[model samples]
Target: MADLKLKDLRYLVALADTRHFGRAAERSFVSQPTLSAQLKKLEDYLGVQLIERAPKRVALTAAGEEIVERARRILEASEEIVELAKGHRDPLAGQLKLALLPTIGPYLLPNVAARLRKQLPRLELMLYEYQTDPMLEKLHSGEIDVGILALPVQMDGLDSYELYKEPFTVAVPTSHKLASRQSIKVDDLAHETLLLLEDGHCLRDQALDICSGADVNEKQNFRGSSLETLRQMVAAGVGITLLPELAGRGAYGAARGVTIRPFVKPVPTRTIGAVWRKSSARREAILALAKLIEAHAL
Candidate 1:
């Protein structure tokens, strides 16, 4: 560790992440030979082999894995320090990564992103459309700086701030008997086939939990890989489905024969929130994104 420079640590960490010397070098903006040489020096200083090099790929040794884990935190901290210093001059002038849940991303990101780019001109925003599990993983791993997801996640080691609560609505075919009803109860669809997104979607789970007796995989009629697909299926009279309030607006406009009606008494709702690792160093950036989302959602 005595002779190990910050640059050398960085090269090793990059190699660990990319698992390719050439690509790591490209990411570090250094020549392959230079990065390889530094890595060799670091290994020599440690008196152990850190990487197993082959013609086309590289694998980390046990020691390399441990060191790389620590190196990632060091690099994160170093980057945070730089950002903090820069923010002293301008509060928002660095890269920010925000993860959005699949259900919400398509419906909300476009309108929000346009306003964000205009307001924070220097902020380089990276958007990731992800599901609940992967979104939380990225947040904890520092791969993503913020996440927009439903509340009641009850995840440890992260903080969530509720942006708003959106109600669930019933999606039915325009010609269906229940289409003209101002609001439909869960029991209204109890006898009808219920279309839902696949298992991975949180909304699917929400729908099932809300309607205890409703059949989710009524193979004869239930299916959709996305909200749009569900809307289309509902329009085709395949089955009725539940949709979030945010998605109801204009969701049926493009589809041929569908209508969105609110729920009757005891409606189900989901709380959407901004989530970040409690230990994150990018507090300001995370808060800024949360504020942006809240403003745009309004």
Candidate 2:
């Protein structure tokens, strides 16, 4: 039997991940026919049917599932080897893929990116925005190098460095009764209609936790997909929503008809942090980035 190539293994993993020929081909950066032919060659070389292919679906055989698990480790190790070689050259001069949650990215990344560019002039930063779950999945799978998200994620196999804590503020229409308050407590929001981001966003869960003991009820009929949308809803007098400190200072807060007010003492806050795999080879760079983020978080 011929020695299997790393590219073939990558293709197999991509197929397993996407479960669609065209999608896998796109991810592997190859044409559909080419991916199909290579997969066929791989199957013939191994003398086993790895996938059950139908017109609309793809399923991996039991052996294929096991092979994919091993393949992922091999791919991760290969990346570590490349990163190790690069690490010896420069600490922060190569491509760094950073994942950020939508809740934090728009409010924080501009300043952080500017600082990183000035400090590490040769660093090429690639930013990808995803919610917490998918971002962590990508980090563990070696698809992304680092992730910026709320801390206390409760995930294993990852190490996080605390950057800063951001407090949440209440956003309401200027005409709303609470908008005139100097500062309100969590209990003040008990009877208010709270607008929240959709389920996938960590901000939603954080907001819910803040209002846990209160009598606040989420507006079940509608959910904002992003912070801007939530701000718009507040401006339009739909319902009040919680905004992170940085977000409240952004354009949304500056928008007319929307007033942002802080919570009284012991405010609800989320700790922002940088996270990466514990065994990653780019630890030094990630830590450096984290320091820069911490400095600029204010």
Candidate 3:
């Protein structure tokens, strides 16, 4: 069998990751027919089928799964070599792929990204927005160099540095009784219909944890897909919801008919942090970015 090229392995990995021909081709930056033909050649060269093809679905064969895992390791090692070389040049130079959660990105990034550009002019910053689980998955797979997310994340083989502790605030419609309060306590939430983000968001779980001390119940029939949606719901008097401090200062909390109140002493908060693979060669760059974010995140 002929030796496989790095690009071939990359295509296989993309296909394995996405499980769709069109998406894999787009990820690999190749045409669909080109990716298909190259994959066919790879299969012929290896004398085994990599994927089970159907009209509407793509499934990796057992062999494909094993090969894809090996391909990931090889690609990661190759990237590490490149990063090691770049590390000696300048700590903040070159491309850095960073993943951030949707909850934090809008409120925090706008303030920090400009500072980053001015401080590290040579740095090429690439950003991806995702939820905590997918962000961690990308970090572990070496698809992203770092992740900025809310902490207390329990994942092995990664290191994180706390940037800031962001407190949660109660958002209520102007007509709501809680809106008249100067401050709120966990007990105040009891028996209130709390609007929350849908599943897969860390903020939703964090809010639930804060409410655990009280008898707070969720708006079972309604789950906002984003914080903006929840803010809208609150402003419309649908239900009250929790907002991160930064978010409270943003446009969402400033919407008409909405009132924002801070929690009393021992306020519920989530620690935001920057996390990277423990073995990453871009540690200095990631740390540098973290420092910049920490300075402006508040």
Ranking by TM-score: 2, 3, 1
What's the CA RMSD for each of the models? 14.5, 17.0, 17.3
Please provide, for model 3 over 161-260, each residue's C-alpha lDDT reduced to its tens digit, 9 standing for 90 to 100: 9999999999999999999999999999999999999999999999999999999889988879999999888988989999999998855557899999
Q: Which 10 consecutive positions of candidate 3 have the poorest summed lDDT?
A: 246-255
Local error of candidate 1 at residue 213 (angstroms): 5.7
- Runs of candidate 1 with Cα error greater than 4 angstroms are 1-89, 213-222, 251-253
Alpha-carbon lDDT of model 1? 0.83
Cα lDDT tens digits for candidate 1, 1-298? 5776789899998899899988999999999999989999999998999999988778999999999999888989999999888776555767778888888887776657788888777878888888888888888889998889988785799888888787888888999999989988777776777888887788888888887865344545455888998888888888888888778774333567888889886888988999888887777767877787787774
Preferred candidate (TM-score higher): 1 or 3: 3
Candidate 3: count the clashes: 0
Report how far residue 206 has shifted in candidate 3, in Å: 0.6
The CA lDDT of each predicted structure is 0.83, 0.91, 0.91
